[model samples]
Target chain A: MASHGLTYDGCNFFRQRLLLSTLSGKHVKIKNIRSRDDEPGLRDFEASFIRLLDKVTNGSRIEINQTGTTLFYQPGLLYGGSIEHDCNPQRSVGYYLEALLMLAPFMKTPLKATLRGVTNDPTDPTVDLLKSTSLPLMKKFGIDGEAFELKVVKRGMAPGGGGEVVFTCPVRKTIRPVQLTEPGKIKRIRGVAYSVRVSPQMGNRIVESARSVLNQFLPDIYIYTDHMKGVNSGKSPGFGLTLVAETLNGCFLSAEMSSTPQGQGDPVLPEDLGRNCAKLLLEEVYRGGCVDSSNQSLALLLMTLGQQDVSKVLLGPLSPYTIEFLRHIRDFFQVMFKIEVQKPLEDERKGGDKVLMTCVGVGYSNLSKTIK
Target chain B: HSERESDEEEEQGALKWKEGLQQKAAEAFLRQQAAAPNLRKLVYGSVVEAQESEEEEEELGGLFRVSRPQQSKKVQANTLDCSRFHPDTFHNWDVEEMLDSIRDCFVTGKWEEGHDAA
Candidate 1:
């Protein structure tokens, strides 16, 4: 690492740079963050994210200019323990939890996080979606145990948000390399249609409409209706649907849609929301892969940090965010994936061309974990 | 000698159509290759590092600098940082052909040999 560490411009890909810096033990300096905007600086959500990062690690050094345009972060050791955070309502809890998911496994002790804020929103993946898809994806990397769980204690929508979730994860010495090339035929499709601070019938309506679209493909489709009432429901009135397709090879592909926050845009009917969410799932199925699109970065990150061995994962067309993540991985770990495009056979009815990513792990071990 | 010359001319005309056939095929192949593109290059290559040099400010008279609107590049640099991959709008799920395209992805669809639902 250079004495001055890595330097980046702009606020785009903010979490990726900081997360990689923490893992690689490199200092990072970011400048020109919304410098030209009318209100030029970091937003509340980003500051909350920085504070959360500060809480998880010890002896970390963070500096920001008066306008918050420039930021310097020197990451400290991973000291995992119980912590609480009030995530900014501008973004959902998923925004914060995504970073914790990447960093939790390598901590010195088990991590128990209580996060309060919007649990479901349009901009980011909802906590429900991440719980269904990301947790199972992490299990494939051998980070599974009874303690590995994400629980949603309350349901919250966006805007005037009030929701809570508890996430707990066990530390790991080293991640296991995996070969997840084949995502077998999807046997069943399961989903959750949740409504908070709205009529309980909204949940049922969403479930019905979603199943109507999904029933065309498979007979074993079930969507649960969850209606949280009273204090459990967040401050906003909204509903959403999260669908996951489970394949025979234990691969999961998921998609979700949350209603527009109150006073943000035109209100959405539960029926429309459900039908559209199902269509999103079909889109995900069309981009068939061993891992879903939202979790592609997580899968790739674990592969890069796995024990020094070959890890191969078959993925659908790379998203723009994932393409950027691949470049950042190269800069951080010096690991480049061998990208190969696999064209489907003439008789095969698979959706589209698949990309096979193969790389040798850097043999990253949790140095902070105390020896038993 | 005149008849032999005529025969030679006829032979030359007959073989003229084969001219540049190899070159045409090579050009067509190159076009096809360019259409697909190399995924590795798309991911790791063509990194246009943001230039640090600021654009020269326009001076109005001898008093103040005119503030220019931020460019598209500047806007992109400071956009929201979220990881949700929005679906492409090109796919309309209502079409029957579109539905058939991924029919084999489910267990109800055609199964490959030696792979049973059991």
Candidate 2:
């Protein structure tokens, strides 16, 4: 397995394959990416993502066939530094940033990335949600310093992206093992209702409707109404809400709903979007885990690279992406997690069954980190 | 004497040992094993590793096997990689029963005996 590369089918979970390959120093080959579709082969966005990956690494070998159906990636050293990439507008900046957050801490140098593209979209976790939830989750794993930040320089919606975001992360020689079992009670629910290239009143309408739904649970609810205009607003007219439920123990579970990008889908009223987004937050609360569903794989990756000690985390039902990621982690690192279901007590009104994942880290250290 | 009488008592104790003791222990062990769902097996063992090539080779005019892409497990491996966990059935938020299900997750809800917000 060391001499031969791991081969996968399709372009799904494409980032995970490459990210794992880079961290594990294993070559990966993916074939038949959308080979049967009407417009077969890799999309322009995937090629753009590969280009971004190439920009961040050094001496990486990548090969693709003429139809772009098959790709072979021989990962190179993660030489992270200040870099910028023009993200494909098909997917949001959040899509690219998600992969970057995983690889940033293990880089040779601290990463300061300026990503430009759509900041919010319907298909992926938006930038606001990632900033509010994922960054804090990484902090719990001791990946924090003044350099850790995800600043949204501009707000952009899908289709016609003009957004910009700067993500900076400090490299860690070794990740700290965490035992995040309890989520604690949600103390306050904070949210941002943002609208760009739309009526300023749209932001207000979303806040009022969302407040009406979430005020039933807690009084400490504050939804900030942000209406960006002029050049800061992207080319599309859209409004969305990102709700973060902050627990007493600093666990952030987030839910978001983005309006349909202009001309792509049916336009949604700001009131309806807000009400539905608040309901989504309630649904997330019912799922109820220390790490939100979207960041489960990120948390698990940090745990996998921690010092050689047992790390435990309580997560809601594993997302399909996370489940596939677990299989990949086993293939790359030979680390298998002990999963256990923790059913809520009979009298407890908590939502669903939580799975506790336990794994002893492989004690992977960033050997590339220059020792001063 | 008394020592001989005690020896007789020990002999009777050995003869009247607990019946089905071994069987009882085995049943208890089996029940314990069944109670806790083996999560390790669910994660690793449930992964379908066999790449089943189910497609029958189609030969046109007795030459050249036509290779059509399969919509099998291999195809699904290439599905959308989004992390959203869309539940099959969403809870109707308008219903009071659904709202009551997650009441304890909030600080306003009931706290355990030892823990208090104050």
Candidate 3:
């Protein structure tokens, strides 16, 4: 098989095909299968089998679906019941097995993500503003590990029975069951999560914030999100989808675009013809876009965009309608997020996620303060 | 072709600056984003290569970051800066009040009842 380095262009190529929905654009569904044996080999073998098939096919699609006791199957299915039959290994090794699938030839996984609305942040990553923590790098990455993004349409119980999580992403694959050090037995380690929702109502808060903050901090973010909006078919569920907590630090600038997956309806180019097929396919993520965690520059940009420090740049002084929108936003955050800004990063502070929110306009005050 | 060239220029420019908020943003914004929580902040992606030893991490004073050096300078506010762009929009402040009350309830480090429901 050719060892072409994976890239955003390759991603775009797949995206275009998704838009067309050509006959050859098959989607490989990663349905969680119920298995008793917790053998690492079995896991690797299954993932490898799917990947190998992907290599043979010209360019296949991927659909990531996890199962547990509460898993739902679409009519007559190949895998049934919650695949989380074995509680420990299922959570632990199972995730690992699925992730390694990305390295295989058949594993051309489409990056999946969501966009949370922009909000005020006063503290920015500066030289100062933070202390430190005892979390190991791997564990930190595990709980909030940034890597090849994998998204799925999950069906499960919501936290606090907040309705059904339904289409939530659930957990990132990196976190797993581990044997606790020092005293006693074993338990599963938990990781943090962010949710996102995009809809008419969602535009009110998250997208509204994105309009201002995203434009100021991460302008390119809007470019990418807007460009890809056509390919994504994700539904807007009133509430915003939470972002991966790690990316939250820098996604200061946000935007919404009408994205359509790459290929709406078509076939592989005649010259593009090849004879391989893969089972696991990637799905196009639309309005709710997440940054590819592997791109280091993007993380930096997100932080800059979300930085609480007020840098002036003809941000507004717009028409009455736009100004009213800003007014309502401030009122909402003050009452809702009640975000606090503590020890704002001085202009010179260097390193740290020192930015904080105080639910006050101070987060974006400096220049705007005089505006009103 | 022109677009690719501009991107290269931007990337090169990003690489040259060593320290600044914009630089940090440039770094973090370019990193990978597989999965994360909501409240985390500006952090760039690294290769995820394991360190050689415990002492090595400590040797760097635990200040080693995998992303590129900072590459931005704080833009001094011009007249009608970004903040002034949308000066009047307001939102529901009640949610903030609720969270503040919940935070106050957790005098200790534990969640009490539905304290964390928000």
Q: Report the alpha-carbon TM-score of model 1 versus the true structure.
A: 0.90
Query: lDDT: which is higher, 2 or 3?
Result: 2
| Superposed Cα deviation of residue A288, candidate 3 (Å) | 23
Clashes of each: 0, 0, 146
Task: List native contact recovery per candidate, as a fraction of 1.
Answer: 0.89, 0.79, 0.00
Better model by TM-score: candidate 2 vs candidate 3: 2
Predicted structure with the largest DockQ when compared to the true one:
1
Q: How would you encode candidate 1's per-residue C-alpha lDDT over A1-372 as one tens digit per residue?
A: 335488888999999999989898889999999897899889999999999999899888999999999999999988989999999999999999999999999999999999999999999999999999999999999999999999999888999789999999999999999999999999999999999888999999999989888999999998888899899998999999999999999999999999999998899999999998999889999899999899999999999999999999999888877888898899888899999999888988889889899999999999899777
User: Considering summed lDDT, which 10 consecutive residues are worst modelled in model 2 chain A?
Assistant: A1-10
Question: What level of docking quality does candidate 1 show?
Answer: medium
Cα misplacement distance, residue A296 of candidate 3 (Å) = 10
Instruction: State each model's TM-score restricted to chain B.
Output: 0.51, 0.47, 0.14
Task: State model 2's lDDT.
Answer: 0.89
Task: Report the candidate with higher lDDT, 1 versus 2.
Answer: 1
- DockQ of candidate model 1: 0.64
Query: Candidate 1 chain A: worst 10 consecutive residues by lDDT?
Result: A1-10
lDDT of each: 0.90, 0.89, 0.21
